[model samples]
Target: MRLIKRLLPAFSMAVASAAYPVEWSGNLAVEVRTFPSTAQWPEQKDNGLSLSFQPELRHRWNDGDQAFTFIPFVRVDSMDEERTHADIRELKYLHVADGWEVRAGIDKVFWGVTESQHLVDIVNQTDLIENIDGEDKLGQPMVRVTRVLEDGAIDLFLLPWFRERTFPGAEGRLRTPLVVDTDQARYESDAEQKHLDYALRWNQTIGAVDAALSWFDGTARDPELLPGTKGSESILIPYYPQLRQAGLEFQYTGEAWLWKLEAVHRDTEQEDYRAAVGGFEYTFVGIHDTPLDLGVLSEYHYDSRRLAANSPLQDDLFIGTRLTFNDTQSSEVLAGGIFDLDHAGKSFRVEASRRIGQSYKLSLEGQLFSDIASHDPLAAFAADDFIRIELTRYF
Candidate 1:
């Protein structure tokens, strides 16, 4: 505790000095949500409301010959309960030179194509949905360097890692029981476990199109279940092992339209599973002067080594729009559906939100799952849905 207290002041001083050349700017946002159980899943009902608020700060640094770059970020989020604990959201330091750039600290690293379904969402933030199901990965300490060439740039990054558990639902929301014994029960903190991650990427621009390719490899400690477990013969605890993944992405950002595509392949020897995902997104802007933004996102996923291994494909679709009202406020509406193209079930979601100001917002989001055919064993569960309303203020 004494050491932490000593480090805090030094950290703050460094950050303050780093912002010496810039002005201060920030924004705040808040949200709330609620869930109600349906006939299909009567046991799960009246999930309480979740509220969250995030405040951001940004500083602009001036370096001659280089453009004025601003690093905008969220400082922290305050939640209502243990499920909604405060966590570090973003902390980035950037330096731009002639043809070289360096960025260090924690920030969102977007490396995929799907607008709604992200196969590589390593950074976690607080939102209506995220507040319910916590993020799968914690903030990773990293340093990145980029060098620009004639038409592209080469990038390299090193990440000092951490491991996180994937909850059944949103962070603060109630969770369903584990249907399989293979599910992890808790995180392990043994000394023998190793955790480290490294990545390399290249981004190039051709005429009016841009493309990026990245490879990531990491090792984590995971736990496995022993024999004599309840539902199944065994379960897996959070032990440690190696995890590897590679991904490629492409995008075309035109004057009024944007197109994106991405694919990822992941392998985990510990879990004895291999998975792949492919997705695409397109957005058109400025319709009738209302800033109408329309987007469609789709994802195809396949997994090897599961109880029902034969059925390995799942797909989802998301259609959404954003309407900006004036300069400080906006409204957004989205509809999504998930289908087991190879099975007999579907899940649908509808979400809407209104930004009242920089510090406050209102929203409504819900999801429903239906079993269409003979109720695939995986689809035996009934439809589950919820409604949420929240008010937030940021510091």
Candidate 2:
């Protein structure tokens, strides 16, 4: 709330003198999920429903040299208290000059090019309650300066505040047996969330290839789940440590092939490790003499931590296919699976979406977990096969 209050006045002041009109756009969505298997925990539910709204407002003045943007998001869930929350997705002011640009306030920055996992994306905190894939993020407060060149750019960041990662409540499905107690969170820095962090990146595009190198020094976004006791019940406590990370992102674009790689080497007080994800995607345009295009994707994930890694993507192979129908409705379907090489675990997902009429869209998704070994990190959710349906209205 303090952040919102601070940014709103700044935004009004930045664009008050200009007579340009503000543009408004966003979406309202309702989502439903059903679990076929029984709940793993006694407090969990078999079905869940949520409603979310995100509205964006943008204003540009001084002939596109200056701009202000505000985006707010909120979600209400029927089953999980932690899932029902509100956030400022973006609230930033931008100033463009001859060869540089400056952005200030809370915003989101993404820095990876992978379909299965994002290894180099660390600017924003993960909104874990929204999804298990870690695609959603909470906005970060920063002041950024970018120096543009003929073929490359350099970005420098000054981050003032850190947002903690969200976790599923005890009543939420797809959670561990013991709930996470967020109130007991601990940090290595004396200032905790107020610790100042900084980062820099250099991005360049040379012909058919795009590459970026980045470095960050800050409190780690992902926390270590340490065992603790909340009253009489055992729970997990989040412990954040200071970290330094170096990341690289590479992509090659061709007529029919796309190659991507994201790698990171991170160091902390406790440990240091390297992880990477590399893949190639090939597209078959106008397959079978039709207007449909099919793309095949293959990726490999590797981590030095192996079994000691935090997530389940260590030493795994991912294969996926995307089908796009070049029609008026803009229909698409994506199916993918990850196979664990060491534990014989498999995770599969399918997603399909199509526009309805002019203002509405419908999407369906299914997740299947099978053949998980007992030693695998994802073995706890072996019985949690679920499907999701979503309806979104754009305005």
Q: For each candidate, what is the lDDT?
A: 0.53, 0.93
Each candidate structure's TM-score, on Cα atoms with residue i matched to residue i, is 0.68, 0.95
TM-score of 1: 0.68
lDDT tens per residue, model 1, 277-336: 555555555656665666655555645543344232433333444343333466777777
Model 2: per-residue Cα lDDT over 3-106, one tens digit each: 99999988886677446878899999999989899887888888889999999999898999999999999999998999999999999999999999999999
**Number of the top-ranking candidate, with TM-score as the measure:** 2
**CA shift of 243, model 2, Å:** 1.0
